[model samples]
Target: MTRTLLLFATILTSTQAQQGFGPLDPTPPAAPIPQILTHMAQQESAFANARDHYTFRQDVTFETLAPDTNQPDGAYHQLTDISFDDAGRRQEHVVFAPANTLQRVTLTEADLDDVAHRLPFILTTPELPDYTLTYLGRQRVDQLDTYVFDCTPREILKDHRSLQVEDHRYFQGRIWLSQQDHQIVLIHGQAVPQDTRPGHENLSPPFTTYYQQIDGKYWFPIYTRADGTLHFPAHADALSQTVHVRTTVRYTDYKRFHATVTLHYGTEVPTTPNPPQP
Candidate 1:
């Protein structure tokens, strides 16, 4: 009998109330829901574009825990710098990567992709139509007031072609938007459409991502954490097994990239503006 362990992604709830904030207020927002959603979509779209101009470092850690003792049995760690070249082309440089030692589960390409992209979980104007966002209420997160909304995919395509391509996964969960800026401040959810086909079970755990304001303009993902168990069902000649997984990703050292160009003609001098000091 052969068993395979696959790890994926998701989000979890936060203990906001216990953190000294008031409970979620169920009263309707003063502004129209449609208006609020529109504003959020626009703001998020701008933020997404702005993020591409910034360089940052990402550190990821994944661990598999022993079932009985809840102690780490195996782990994986990597540190990567995401930046741009002189030509302004994006580049990824691995600064540190330790050998993976996890025996219970294996990280799939989808899993790595999720850690790089989906874990940050941005919902811009173009992605708005793919999801149904429901206004939950208003809530205060520390010093900031936020609008709470439940988010779910409108549909998960289950056709044979789409399934084979593995392209229908979507984020399903809740988000907190800053009331003043209409920008996403936090996200709690998981990727959807987990493949449970016999002989091929892929499960994801819930996660939570917190954001911090960057340049006092856009909110950016700063930390993400997921801790849960995946139950792989029994298949032909294989027995069911549960694997506990924990993952944390940190995005830091954000520095915006500014390109400078200078051109001079015959007997002409061009003055290039000084680049901003780091």
Candidate 2:
């Protein structure tokens, strides 16, 4: 009878083990998120090959809508001609309205030296972070398996500023990155508040950016669309002294290496004054 009892106890213990009710834990360690971001950064950093000088042409369209306006009211169309050197330094950014009509032309040479330092604000800088990556989750964009992540602010001041009682100024939206190359194929998120007002303090706009591979190395945005509300003081109402203004910007029709040009990069560039004609 004692032997029979021992056998029954052993059988019960085995049954529990088989049913996953044993003493051992089952959860596995999660993959490090920073490591994934680092991997993405490494891939993007080596994308573009170093060249002596390269130029790209871009078309820009900007529109702003007033309060309660069904359509965009303020519209502007312009073209940008940018040149970069082998060291990935911007030499010139000639902005024209149409037919080479010079609206604003920047020469890295003397007399216009100050503006050259600010080129990174407009053109891509070699050392800049490829993207702000936050692990979103596994999702599909365009029927392809992708990992969703949030692009955080790579700039310090831009990231620390809060939007409202509980909001982050930078990286408040979500992005979908392709699992294959870890490239940001689609981005959907809200824009950081541009102004501080009573009801408008925490306002955020919806922004989307789409990336496509260019020259097989670089992944640049082929298309982008963003719309957001800008708040303004209500003229007549004091208690409710703010109205939402809609604004949008879109980019299309990209052309690469339109012209062969020479680039000179340094703090000082040789200036060539207009040669006096006889």
lDDT on C-alpha atoms for all candidate structures: 0.84, 0.46
- Model 1 CA deviation exceeding 4 Å by range: 1-21, 84-90, 157-165, 260-278
Q: Could you tell me how far off, in angstroms, the CA of residue 181 lies in candidate 1 after the best superposition?
A: 0.8
Candidate 1: minimum summed lDDT over ten consecutive residues — where?
3-12
| Model 1 steric clash pairs | 10-190, 10-206, 10-207, 11-189, 11-206, 11-207, 12-207
In order of appearance, the predictions have TM-scores of 0.82, 0.53
Give the per-residue lDDT of model 2 (tens digit) for 13-57: 666545421232222214466655565556555543322134555
**Backbone N/Cα/C clashes per model:** 7, 4
The C-alpha local distance difference test score for the whole of candidate 2 amounts to 0.46
Give model 1's TM-score versus the native structure.
0.82
Model 2 collision count: 4
* Highest lDDT against the true fold, candidate: 1
Best by TM-score: 1
